[model samples]
Target chain A: AQSVTQLDSQVPVFEEAPVELRCNYSSSVSVYLFWYVQYPNQGLQLLLKYLSGSTLVKGINGFEAEFNKSQTSFHLRKPSVHISDTAEYFCAVTNDYKLSFGAGTTVTVRA
Target chain B: DVKVTQSSRYLVKRTGEKVFLECVQDMDHENMFWYRQDPGLGLRLIYFSYDVKMKEKGDIPEGYSVSREKKERFSLILESASTNQTSMYLCASLSQGTNYGYTFGSGTRLTVV
Candidate 1:
């Protein structure tokens, strides 16, 4: 069975400040990792994905993540955030066809 | 662009009532999935259909049932609605291969009283 863990439940950052949301996964087999962002009352949108390539993956909205196989982590980061960037972010791992998701981290960008 | 559409945005049902949530995908995706989203829990899969009339149980499937009658339509059914079942229901679709990502619907918020 595969599982994902998001270390932070909530992260608050001021406008123009950088932010990072940590995620870790446990899987016996090889896995595919992803990051998704959800605004209030909206569906999830894909941020970035790590299939098999370079460790660094860039995504929409100036978001990026690095896949560290040794650490079993795929953490999302943004150099600078805006007030509109406040949303809930989720990290997911796919084991075969089933996808395991983390608890989610709420990012609040204050003005 | 891929689009997945759910039938309802908000629904209110009484306990013990039968409820049905419909989902349709225009991308002709072969895989369709149903999930429930909660505060702490990001998204828990309820059921998924790899093809028409073929369904599989996901992480949480005890209280829900699913049907995929056509290639583009997948439905989630609640035999008997309960307060605990009230949550945001999401539908997603993706291509068969690994290179593509999932496209999700707006989601239906179901509240059982």
Candidate 2:
């Protein structure tokens, strides 16, 4: 069984401030991690993915995540966020053929 | 680019009524998945299909059933709709496999009264 844990349920950041959404996973086999973002009243869009590459992967919207295998973590970060960046972010891990998603974290970017 | 399309944007059904949620993918994706999203619960997979007539139960499949008769369409069924089943249903498609990126639909908001 593979499971992903998103450490934060809600993250509040001022506009232009940096933010990080923490995620961790537990898996026995090779890991595939993904980040998806959902704006209000919208479906999820892939932010980034880590298959098998350099630990650091950059994604859309100026977001990036570092996959630390030893730590079993993939944390998404942005140097600065805009008010439009407020949305729900999801972390997902693969279990063989299926993808298991975390509970999710709501990012609230306020000006 | 892949486009996963859910048939309905909003649906209101009475309890005990049968509910059908339709999803279609345009990219000839081999993998299609149905997930329900709720507050605090990001997205819980209900069922998925890798190929036509082939379906697999996901993490949560107790109250849901699915039909994938054709390669491009996947349907989620609530045998008997209930208030607890009210949530946003999302349809997603992966071109290659789980390792590939997923394209998601806008979602269907189902409300069972």
Candidate number of the best TM-score: 1
Over 4 Å off in model 1, which ranges?
none
lDDT minimum window of 10 residues, candidate 1 chain B: B94-103
lDDT of 1 by residue, B1-113 (tens): 88899999999999999999999999788899999999998899999999999999998998899999899999999999999999999999976565667888999999999
| Candidate 2 interface RMS | 0.9
lDDT of 2 at B14: 100
Lowest-lDDT window of 10 residues in candidate 2 chain B?
A: B94-103
The lDDT per prediction is 0.92, 0.91
User: How do the residues A21-91 of candidate 2 rate in per-residue lDDT, one tens digit apiece?
Assistant: 99999987788899999899877889999998799999999999999998999999999999999999999
Candidate 1 Cα lDDT to native: 0.92
> For model 2, what is the error of residue B22's alpha carbon versus the real structure, in angstroms, after optimal superposition?
0.4
